[model samples]
Target: MKEMCPNCKSNFAAKDINNINKNSIFIEKQCPSCNKWFCLNKTLTIIKIIGIFLLLITSLLNIFNIKSEYSPVFSSIGLVGILMAIIVTFFGKHETVK
Candidate 1:
């Protein structure tokens, strides 16, 4: 991804390493040209979805191997998670704060 500095309007390559959150919860970067800051929330990651269901919940729904009576419900939730991730990753807006 390329981010443009709001001050200088110069584009720069985006890297996860540029994030500055001490707890590693956000993606933060500063423009090399103007030294301005930008940040994006890390809520769109598919890994977070996987962590919630497959890893943390230890559910078979992740692998499409659900055999329980709640299989349909679990499947729906998984599909929603995938859709949300894709939309957030591509079309989500950026926010800046002090």
Candidate 2:
């Protein structure tokens, strides 16, 4: 997502970094050219989606060819986890500061 710097009117991408809250959150990045802080929430959501996908892949591998009798139950729970991740990552209020 592109946002125009309110200070200099220069456009730049927002960068996200870890915040104090345990929940996933958006943070603003300064414009590289103009040094103006702007929100990067949309960009951060994309990163969150990618991370979720990686988690899903790892969970699937763990569920494969397991000797445990509870493998099926574990796999089902993994599927549900993936679903929850998708919902939490994608089904939230967001705005792109154009």
Best by TM-score: 1
Regions of candidate 1 where Cα sits further than 4 Å from its true position: 6-9, 15-22, 41-67
lDDT of each: 0.57, 0.53
Candidate 1 positional error at 52, Å: 6.1
Which window of ten consecutive residues has the lowest lDDT sum in model 2? 15-24
TM-score between model 1 and native: 0.57
Superposed on all Cα atoms, the candidates' RMSDs to the truth, in angstroms, are: 4.7, 8.0
Question: Could you tell me which residue pairs clash in candidate 1?
Answer: none
Position 18, candidate 2: lDDT: 25
Candidate 2 residues 1-98, lDDT tens each? 44455556665453532222223355444556644444535655665565566567556666575556666665676666666556645454333244
**Residue-by-residue lDDT tens digits, candidate 1, 1-98:** 76655556677776622545545455666766666665554454434455345332324654656567776676676666566656666565545435
